[model samples]
Target: MPPKAEYIELKKSIDTLIEEVATVKEQQKTIMALVEQLDQTQADNLEKDKKIAILENRVADLEQYTRINDVIITGLSIKPRSYARAVTPENGGEPAELDVTSTERQVAAFMQSKDIQLDCNNIEACLPLPKRGTNGKPSVVLRFVNRKHKIALLKQGRKLKGTNVYMNDHLTKRNADIARKARELRREKKIQQAWTANCKVFIKLNGTPENTKVLVIRNIEELNEYDV
Candidate 1:
């Protein structure tokens, strides 16, 4: 071939290679930018997950604090007030519906009967909780004027062991479920005892006095961690 034609073909081949190299470099830059963006997104998602976990823990703490002054009394039947009933003709009166009294009075009287000595004035509110099923009596949820009053009532609750009534802390649904699981663990001999205080479930594992494990249940996963 002629020298000039060969030089022209070589120059064209060099230019094409340079263009392909530039295109490849551009693609590499684009790929690097995308990788950096994906890395940042992953970091942001991890940080967000951490923040969400922290917020959830804070919310759980706040929920527990709100229940500090609450207590539940179960198996306390509502008693009829002793008073003269007015005869009425609203489809034959029937003792005027047992002369219903204020809930505070009823709760105070019930606690007094149980020897808990709770003052009516110290009770902030009292109401009957909805019955769970068809048979058992509805429980009474009582809010006290202060945490100390609630604590005192709980401390005195042990006296009602042989009686027909029982008392417990007013726990949130999550804590209540945890407490139930803890109790189940105790019944299965996985723990010595399970109890709730201040809306937290506690477990006592069987061990020597020095090694006896007492754990506060913050999540259900903790139950699976126990070797028992």
Candidate 2:
């Protein structure tokens, strides 16, 4: 009611309002700091993921490089009876049946028949893969002493298309799965052609090599890049 009493009451109200404003400013500062920390954490996680991806790719490249000198031959006629028989050397040496080189010699002979310049000496190692079922002959997985020999065989393999003999580059399991899926895509009419060369998978969506762009499939996920 009096001027002095009214002035004191207004001063008290102003002080209370100032305290509430200060509290709101402090809360705003705390919220902004939390948001900044979250942004930094996300950026750090993204950097870590990129590094892991780079390391994985390098390991895959090394695995493929080791298999560059290997190839697999399927549909070769190798009888089970002669599977353990010894093979005589070209120099007219004794029949070395205990050595179990009959398969190697047979594979060497088969390659020669195809006009691919190779011999038992060129074969660094040879092992017959188990036959899928009871009927067909087992596929031969072989490594060459020289990379050139593998390349020569691959180049000459195209002529054996109509015949039972088939050859393919030896690929890592990851790459093999990718190749298998690529071929499946081709058979499904989703792609023009898909094959493996030097242990790398490739796909041609459509069109000729001149017009169409061929894609190299490094990982299986890349297969999804094509629309068809």
Candidate 3:
């Protein structure tokens, strides 16, 4: 081969290699840009999720506050008022609405019969809850003017145990589900004891001290963490 021809061919090969390197660099830059964009989107999504979780917690807290000083009386039989015949909200509140005076009078009367005194005036609001009752009755939820009134009534609530009247803390929907699951776990012998107070569910493992650390369960997933 001639020296000039060989030199020209070598130079052409070097130029082709440099062009290929430049193309690879461009592709690399494009890929890096895409990766950066994806990273930014993920960070924004995480921030949004964090904010949503915070708002949800705040909502849950507010719901908890509403039921903190309330009690659910499951078997207190409250008759449908005369409005049951025919009544509208415009004319008057429905039969199912909160008849504060009627509820207070009936509750006070019932308590009087039980020999357990509950001042009707201490009741802030009383209405049937949106839950079905045992034996085709209605479950009533009552709120007290003071937390002390609620606490005192709960202490005396035990006297009405066999009277088919049951009273307990009014729990929010989420806490009620958690409490129900916790009770089921206790019944299955998965835990020593489970009870709800102030809409909070607590469980105790076998051989744990009654006064020791009572495990608070927030969700059903937390139940799996228990060794029991």
lDDT of 1 at 71: 93
lDDT of 2 by residue, 80-151 (tens): 434344556864775555544477877877777777766667889987888877786668888999988889
User: Given candidate 2, what's the lDDT at residue 185?
Assistant: 87
- Per-structure clash totals for the candidates: 0, 1, 0
| CA lDDT of every candidate | 0.84, 0.82, 0.81
| All candidates: TM-score | 0.73, 0.74, 0.75
C-alpha displacement of 178 in model 2, angstroms?
2.1
Tell me, by lDDT, which candidate is best.
Answer: 1
Q: What TM-score does structure 1 among the candidates reach?
A: 0.73
Q: How many backbone clashes does candidate 1 have?
A: 0
Per-residue lDDT of candidate 1, residues 1-228 (tens digit): 899999999999999999999999999999999999999999999999999988987898799788789998888876544555666788486546444576667877777877777876788888887778899776888998898888888899887988778889988887888898889888888788899887788999988889998889887777886635
Candidate 3 structure quality by residue, lDDT tens digits, 1-228: 899999999999999999999999999999999999999999999999989978986898689888888988887877655332445677666545444447667777888898887887788898875545444656788899888888888889878978989888898888888888888888888788899776778988766466545788776778876535
**Pairs of residues at least 3 apart in sequence or in different chains that clash in candidate 3:** none
Off by over 4 Å in 1: 1-25, 79-100, 133-137
- Backbone clash total for model 2 is 1
In candidate 2, which residue ranges exceed 4 Å CA deviation? 1-21, 75-97, 109-117, 130-137, 162-165, 207-210
